[model samples]
Target: MATGWAGDGAVQDQIDATVEDAVKRARNQLKKGPGLTHCEECDAPIPAARREAVPGVRLCVACQSAHDEEAAFSGYNRRGSKDSQLR
Candidate 1:
């Protein structure tokens, strides 16, 4: 109901915004078509197994790992918890 200074529905607003943002990010990360034969980032050949396993995969395993690591520090408070804000 009331969220003090934020007023009514503020928490819900934040939740909705977070969910929308996550959906947008997920959509952006998804590949539009079949996986590439080579890694887009490093120009290495993509393993057939990986291509089959993950449709539309663009980066090879090593590049994907590095991308994942970088994504982990994307500077967004994905969790959006109060504790995370405090840190």
Candidate 2:
């Protein structure tokens, strides 16, 4: 049962929306087209194995790691919980 102003199944709807957003984000991040032999950011050579493993690979391992680290922190909270909104 939903409390206060929330309608029935509101929590489930929120959960499903969050999951859908995550899925869309993941899909958008997927690389497309041909893989590059060199790292676009560092100009380092990308190994053949990596190119084969990750189709449309652009960055070398080091650059990709750095990129991933940079993208790890997300300031926006998609869930928009009451506690988070208060802060």
Candidate 3:
């Protein structure tokens, strides 16, 4: 538990902060307001079923898939691991 310069429970604190930040980011990203009939990014027609299924949806299936892929590879290292810090 001796973390040198860091206080007790510093690692846990960092983990908790990372989780909270991710939660906040996800909540903030939730689409709000009315759903768009056309994809905002590609101008493709958004299916009615999709619009109803996901309220406030702005992007079509393909565009949303691409966006999700980009988001998945954000490469954010919030844990502050020694290895990552060293690099």
Report the C-alpha displacement of residue 30, candidate 2, in angstroms: 2.8
- Model 2: pairs clashing at backbone N, Cα or C within 3 Å: none
Stretches off by above 4 angstroms in model 2 are 1-29, 76-83
User: Which of candidates 1 and 3 is the stronger one according to lDDT?
Assistant: 3
State every prediction's TM-score relative to the real structure: 0.52, 0.56, 0.55
lDDT of each: 0.89, 0.91, 0.91
Model 3: how far residue 35 lies from native, Å: 0.9
Q: How many pairs of residues in model 1 come into backbone collision?
A: 0
Please list the Cα RMSD from the true structure of every candidate, rounded to 1 decimal place. 7.3, 6.7, 7.2
Best by TM-score: 2
**Full ranking by TM-score:** 2, 3, 1
Tens-place lDDT digits, model 3, residues 15-48: 9999999999998998877799999999999999
Model 1 Cα lDDT, one tens digit per residue, 1-86? 55578968788899999999999999898777689999988999998998888989999999999989987786677878998889
The CA-based lDDT of model 2 is what?
0.91
Candidate 3 runs further than 4 Å off: 1-29, 76-82
Cα lDDT tens digits, model 2, 1-87, are 547899888889999999999999998898877799889998999999999889899999999999999998798886889988998
| Residue 62, candidate 3: alpha-carbon lDDT | 98
